[model samples]
Target: MKSELDDQLCRKYPTLYRDRHGDPKSTAMCWGFDCGNGWFPVIDVLSELLSKHNAEVYASQVKKQFGSLHFYYSGRDKYTDGLVSSAQSLSSMLCEICGSQALIQTKYTGWFTTRCKEHTKDYSDKEYVELDVSKVAYLGFGKAWSALVLILIDSCDWRTEHNGMPATHLSITKEAGKLIVSHSGGDDFTYTIRSLHARFQ
Candidate 1:
């Protein structure tokens, strides 16, 4: 998937494959895609905008947090913010997990994510699935995005949490010999939580 994505990015936006001094390279040097595959279209849009202007842009950060997608870049000037804002707006309507048309933001285990009605799960009204936190499992770890998220697979209907409030505080600790991860906008391990928090701060 990484190779395929790289190839596609290069072919679609060759300017991303350039060196710092504006020399085109065989591989993209400074670009990054830190979000899920669902936001590929948003990335494509941003890439196109950068390429169209020969802007020498470098994508340094991209992620989904607080139930929305975040696309940040280095080497940006006045023209880039507009493109980033547009992409982010589109991401709110699109599911972060599957790119479906999302009508609501869902929360699971104190973490928030945007999902379509079918994929959303309501843990309070329905039975809470016993999450096996004994073993270390990445709740929202991906090569692309570094967002604080709680993912529930094959669950009941989802209930909203935080009422669209942006996540502002996060913490994690040990409880009953299990990792108790929490995030803001809702509900983390200390080092892991701190590192993730640093990304936002």
Candidate 2:
């Protein structure tokens, strides 16, 4: 009976190759259905199976490298229109802080980042300091762009837990009652000139 069913499927979708393992009874074991070649139901089943394995492998790799994996069920193949729509949604969501269209979707990784040429140069300048307020502002904005940087600076060096703490790689410059902070690490945090003096005092 199973052989009859397999024969019918093979006849219906001529492109689907038999499973290399020679298991005619196992529909799940079949392969060789190139994109757009297989019947819709067969394609759906194959896509689900492939995606499940791929997701597991990708999640494990991400966890090993980044210490965490933030996977969400996106209901779309990475190469499909669904993925493109999701990317656009994400870009819109971050528009307030990074500005609309500022986030660039990485082609290789499909990840999004707000770091652009101007921002990159700004961060590079943070590593060195001259007396320029504009340079200091550039660094400060970089820090403001990332909350992690603020937490590190506020908790580690600027707070009382460690006194005479070596100044953060970040340095502050005051001009016309505005504070511009720059870091060699490519971050900038700025505050009102008065607020900075008050915090230190």
Candidate 3:
């Protein structure tokens, strides 16, 4: 009778196995014949594997949920004037043209001036127009200058409108203090630093 019952049970669950030496032991090992402690019922083993997979899925969902919550609660507002003001403060301390210690003075509208005497000798009398260094077709400026130039060109509409204007180019001529923009039109408009600000405003 017991042998018939065991055969029927094994047939019902192909993956299930039993040790029938004297005492009966049930197991769900992948290898149907191996009746070791490691063997578990098929459904129980599959449930554990599925549980581990589900844990990973749940973890990822939680991470995305937290990320979205952070964006809604804090990230958006933290980037307001506080961040801009901090960046501007840092910009004032560093030179935007060259990566040197900028001469912080009342001139240049309290912004950090990048034109050293060597660079500004030619345009000493003329106002030094601050052009976006990124658009100027030159490299070798440090990271800060590159970032500043990128921001000015991207954010400032005036700079964007005049970026690729024909006959417009920045030059460091012998007579210029810093780099000045020479626009070749009817009057050969030479934009000095101060004049550039006026035009933008």
Candidate 4:
């Protein structure tokens, strides 16, 4: 997820992310959200419930795996288990890019991701508002996450007010905005992506 959104969750549920400020060797959170921003709502809801139930539970990890959400935790309870399970199931049907309904769940480029059909295409003839985010992909983790960010951005257009149910489609309205997402530590980015020449670290 984007650092801006990630920050909100952490700040809202400090205890749920108690390990976030700990040594990197001790917590995966120091790497920030190790997944895309599409599932922020899922995490947010889960965090809220967990925090409400027990302010001492720690989320060991919240990431994607096998094209679905995987919310690891320290506290064990039927409610927590049920919540995590539901989020995972919901993730399979929601686009990992925009939180809209997904068409399919499959492995892309050897990585598991759920995407809407529009996010998996290449459109060069279109033009829209562009935010040149040559920086921002890297959320200060390192080379590994930088590469992950590149993959996620290929289909991450956050606008949810467009035409399609997913709000983005292979044949979009000529007036619709554009998007480009990239990675580099200490910052985040989104653009009406022209194209990204990924140079992974």
Find the candidate with the highest lDDT and give its number: 4
The lDDT for every candidate, in the order shown, is 0.47, 0.30, 0.29, 0.56
lDDT, candidate 1, 52-100, per-residue tens = 7555776545567676777655666544654555456556656665766
| Predicted candidate 3 versus true structure: per-residue lDDT over 35-117, tens digit per residue | 11111222122223223323221101000111011001111222222222223332333333342323223343332233433
Candidate 4: segments with Cα more than 4 A from true spot: 122-201
Candidate 3 regions exceeding 4 Å error are: 1-76, 104-113, 125-201
Q: Per-residue CA lDDT of candidate 4, range 1-201, in tens?
A: 887998899899988887776788877767767777777776777677668867778987788888888888898775566556655655665567886555344443465576655664442223322222345433443333333343333333432333121322222111222232333321112221212112111
Residue 69 lDDT in candidate 1: 74
Residue-wise C-alpha lDDT for candidate 2, range 44-159, written one tens digit per residue: 23333334334431111000001111122223343322222222222221222223222222323443333334333433332322212242344454432232233334533442
- Who wins the TM-score comparison? 4
Q: Which scores better on lDDT, 2 or 4?
A: 4
Cα lDDT for residue 97, candidate 3 = 37
Measure candidate 3: CA RMSD: 30.1
Q: After superposition, how far is residue 63 of candidate 3 from its true place, in Å?
A: 37
Sorted by TM-score (best first), the order is 4, 1, 3, 2
What are the TM-scores, per candidate, against the unseen true structure?
0.48, 0.16, 0.20, 0.58
For model 4 the local lDDT of residue 93 reads 54
TM-score of 2: 0.16
